[model samples]
Target: MARSINQVAVFGLGKVGELVAILLADAGFKVVGLDAVPRTMLTADGVELETRPLDVTDAAAFRDSLRGVDAVVCCLPFHLNVMIAEAAYDAGVHYFDLTEDVPTTNRVMELSAAQPAAGRTRPTFAPQCGLAPGLIGIVGASLAKQFDEIRSIELKVGALPQNPTGLLGYAVNWSAEGVVNEYLNDCEVLRSGRRQMVPAMTEKERVLIGGIELEAALTSGGLGTMCETYEGRVARLDYKTLRYPGHFRQMHFLFEEMRLRDRRDEVGRMLVDAKPPVNDDIVYLHAAVEGIKAGEPFRENFVRAYLPLEIGGRLWRAISWTTAASAVAVVELVADGRLPGAGFVKQEDIALADLLDTHAGRLFGHTTITQSERA
Candidate 1:
């Protein structure tokens, strides 16, 4: 029998976590929000989510909490994901998270391969279900399917302030730690039809979307497991983070000139301090694939800009809602028996059409496509 998910526990309860809980509840699932500190009731979009205090690090307590829930979504930091996933595994529940940490995801994949519950297949383990790795990967794969042969697949995502300031011209809208990791860590890519690791923040390129000039460069974890999945299939497959012009230069100076590469935590704090998050933010997504379709040379591009909008009676930043909704959409798919019930779930394997069919996934439906060129 396939696994059925009706109840879910969302761990973290931050800006994104609370929204995830609300979206799940709005989707007709019983939802609970867990956090390290105590939290009162949270309601949104005509749905109320039960909230509780729990230290996810407490393995016994976390495992116990997962007993009644059909699935668990971890919105905690990437470092805490493996611990939370272990508890979910022991409790025999489906697991999902928004982590871009490669090592953490590797650990989760190992857990998914372990023994299943008695008379049932193991629960699904899906990670990197955020905007870049989650929605962007789905888009890239969907475009790749239309081609008989693929030469390259390029993806770019940026969550930035609509109005920028300072030399960086960016805001700390997302996790500063994750941002630092993406900059300092080595990025995985498929070069010349072989898997290769390249330095992040290198190979800078100019990108124009809807007449907006931006810069893009290699970013770690944004590609998720696509490199491994599309290694021999595509000659060039890579994901990059887009930023306003001169943002990468400032970052290069911070990490290279100041030599803060080894001190990621401090760098995160410093960056957050310098550029706090702004309420008015926009998310830009650009996905392009080149290959042959029906024996004809072709290139397809998906480019859109997402702005903050009201959800659950409150306005949410573009970064927060997009991330939360993407993850919730995946959970909805798994619950409705559309996605696999067991083993690790790769974002590339998910269908974009199926994703947009869900309630949460509808947020991506409004696209101001600046480029849909086919040649």
Candidate 2:
């Protein structure tokens, strides 16, 4: 049964979209999904969604697909998000996307200014609502609020296999192109009281979570709004993704020796064609903030774990659930007026504590909010 949907549209039915669409329908919201390939749009109940084979780049068809829709969810690849976001802005529907591409996100934010200046046709615009940047952004920002002068913020997040089977011990849960784009792209970081481009896969560090030791490195795009919000106020800030031991080493080999960094397309195609898929995975988050407290340095740390969940009779790996569920939960929360009414909304705009209180993200854990380390 599709439940009592008010009519929502989801673009893309890959892992994230499938999980989100089913949950939306189950919650009684009519959902229409748009994808270039018709076979990807799964359906249910008389609440059959209105899916149209759309190239998305064709603005005419894209805008037309938004007809009679109140909200739009994008599960498309990051490169494909710009067109859909433009269409959603034109259609005046609340827009949501799962993109970690900073340039793309900045473009959307620029467009957010034009919205509401015209009218409140669209109520909200959220970019980068997936796991790393989205969840970690919220967590890091929340910690920064405690300090009088925010000096430094560091956030680390990752998606990895629960059990290993290969040289990399990794499975491609989402987009291989996205993974390549991030690893090869110019990374952003705040060093020495200034933001600068840092090489990806450097500054490797080890952490213990859920009693399992893991390694973390400077992969791109997890720092959602931290740099923007902190800016000159903070001395140093950065974000990285975490993975199991030896994962970074293997990635370096592929990107360096195999020269995947130079020829991303060939490497992406190779990985897409060759990798073995796995079901079980885990999403890990670690964030810390330091600033002046009573003329002295104070710090706060937070960590959480999210595992797999079964949706639509299929097991949603932790990456799928963590990424999709964060967006789903935020959309539901924003719909209910639990968040801001209009303009660009950052992941950090919503408090971490309140988000965890919600039933959706709580599936992760109670989560330790405040931990101290001497500086």
Candidate 3:
């Protein structure tokens, strides 16, 4: 039987969490916004959201809050995801999050696997349902299906200010801790049909899209489970974070030379203190798949640039809208029986066409192109 999701609890009141609460409320779900600090009262399309003050670190409080809730959408930091996920599993409610941390996601997977044996009702668990690992992974899988034999699959995504005016050439559009983690961790990729790990910030390359040159480098967690999904199939598969030229060199200097990578807490604080958050930003996405179709070599590229959007009677940054919308859309799919209802779900399992048709996902617009372009 398909479980109907009505009441949803969104843990975390940050930018992305706020939007998630609003979007879900507007979609007619009873939304509860929970955070360590109380959120200012707000409404979406005349729906007043219920706000709760609770510390997610308090396992008892967190589990108690899940009572009577149909689903749990976690927008908390990556490190706190496992705790909330375990609580959600204990409460027997659907779980979703935007975490890009590999180890945290693995923990969620483990919890999802420990559900009661068959014939029992187990809630679904899906992670990394955000920009890079979420939408990009779905698009990459869509393109890969078009090829008779996949050779290489590459994904690049970035959230950058529409107008640059700084030395770093970047603004804090999302979580600074997430940015630091990606910069310092080892990235997973597939080479010659085998899975391998490579250091982040390496393999810097210049890429041109829409007549603009941007730099991309190996980044951690952006590939999500795509490397595992495409293992033993694709000859090469990897994901990189896109940034303006000279950005990688500057990051390399800070993490490698300054030794900030050794002390991530200071690095995160430094980045937050230095780079101010920007609302006028663009979310850039690009995915390319190369393979043989009918014995003829071919390649296809998917590209899009998303700017700030007006939704739920407010303006949201591109990063916030893109990330929040992807998570919400997955929830809708799961609720509507369009996706799996129990156990772990991967972003690649979501179809691009289905995602673009959702109310929240539609905010990304329909500008995606599937052309014979090589990258």
Candidate 4:
């Protein structure tokens, strides 16, 4: 009965981009899916849409495409989000992206700060609107509000294949570079109200859920934008990625002893060579909030069971729906004035309850499960 998002533009019609377009289009929005490699994009399973060939690196061309669009949902890889986000700002379009690049997000934040606030006619900028940083930030922030005094918040998420045919039990569902880069980078963790950097694979733990044995270890970007939002409210906060058993050890060798961390170019090349890619995958999310509740310590958790599903005849992995839809929900919310509607917006700025009621975020509501079931 309510219309918030009308005109939409999705940049980069890759594996995830196609799904994003179909879902938004299904929501009764005018959607345009653009890509640099037009040859790589094909019609999604259930929807019929035209693809605009775009070279985002060309500043003028990129801005020209943004004209008259209310919000731009960036489905491009992490590297391109920076350029695309800048263009969105210059074109006076609200921005939403799936970038987990800390540096890129920081730059966007800086740009948002330096630029003049939006007038009544322009859209604001909201970057890094994916599962981990996007949904986790919103959901975790919601749980925090229920507490009298918060202690810590930990968010862990993984976009993996629902059904696997290989030993990794995984597929190239998302960005391979994003995966390898986070694995190698020094991760940030808050311990006792102080911020510290921890090695990616150093802190390992074994977790079993639904009789499915898996491993979770420290990974950058999984915490999303929670670190800045939770600042002093929480004491210890960190994020990890869930993987099948023994997967950590195998990657430890490839990234550490084998020096793939130092030679990621070679490592990324090997992944392209060895592992086959697929579009069928699952997106896993786990977030826990601990704090004092009525003079008692309590924890509130959110978890979900996501799998690839068919929408409008096209099938896409759970990650595509969860990540893209969550970002789009925020875009819609901001457009409708449910959010602040101007300047920089963070994922946590969204109210989880309101988000779950929206069309795009309702996708998360249907796929969700209890924390114990997903853990």
RMSD of each: 1.6, 3.8, 2.1, 2.9
- Which scores greater on lDDT, model 1 or model 2? 1
Q: lDDT per residue, candidate 3, 1-375, as tens digits? A: 544799999999898998898888766678899998896746655656799999776768878899889899999998899888988887788999999899999999998899554554698999999987899999999999888999999999988887876667899878888999998889999999999999998998998877767899999999899988999999999999999889989988898888777898888888778888988888889999998976899888888887888775788888998899999999888888889988999999899889888777777773332234663
Candidate 4 per-residue lDDT over residues 1-375, each given as its tens digit: 465457889997776677677767766678888887664333344446767888777777778888777788888878888887777766766777788788888878876766554563445778877887788878778877888988887777877665665556666667778888888888878888777788987678876555566788998876656777676768988888888777778888787677767887777767766665766666777778888977887887777668776665557677777776887677767767788766788888789988887777777755645563211
**Cα lDDT, all candidates:** 0.89, 0.76, 0.87, 0.75
Query: lDDT by residue for model 1 over 194-286, one digit each (tens)?
Result: 999999998999998888899999999998899999989999999999999999999999999999889999999998999999999999989
Using alpha carbons, what is the TM-score of model 3?
A: 0.95
Give the runs in model 4 whose Cα sits over 4 Å from its true position: 1-5, 39-47, 117-122, 163-167, 371-375
The best candidate in terms of TM-score: 1
Off by over 4 Å in 3: 1-3, 41-43, 117-120, 366-375
lDDT of 2 by residue, 226-318 (tens): 676766788888887777788889888988987667888888887767664567777778888888877787877777776677555566788
Ranking by lDDT: 1, 3, 2, 4
**lDDT computed for candidate 4:** 0.75
Which 10 successive residues of model 4 have the least lDDT summed? 39-48
Indicate the TM-score of model 1. Answer: 0.97
Could you tell me how far off, in angstroms, the CA of residue 363 lies in candidate 2 after the best superposition? 3.2
Question: lDDT: which is higher, 1 or 3?
Answer: 1
User: What ranking of all candidate models by TM-score puts the best one first?
Assistant: 1, 3, 4, 2
Return whichever of 1 and 4 wins on lDDT: 1
Worst 10 residues of 1 by lDDT: 40-49
lDDT for model 1 comes to 0.89
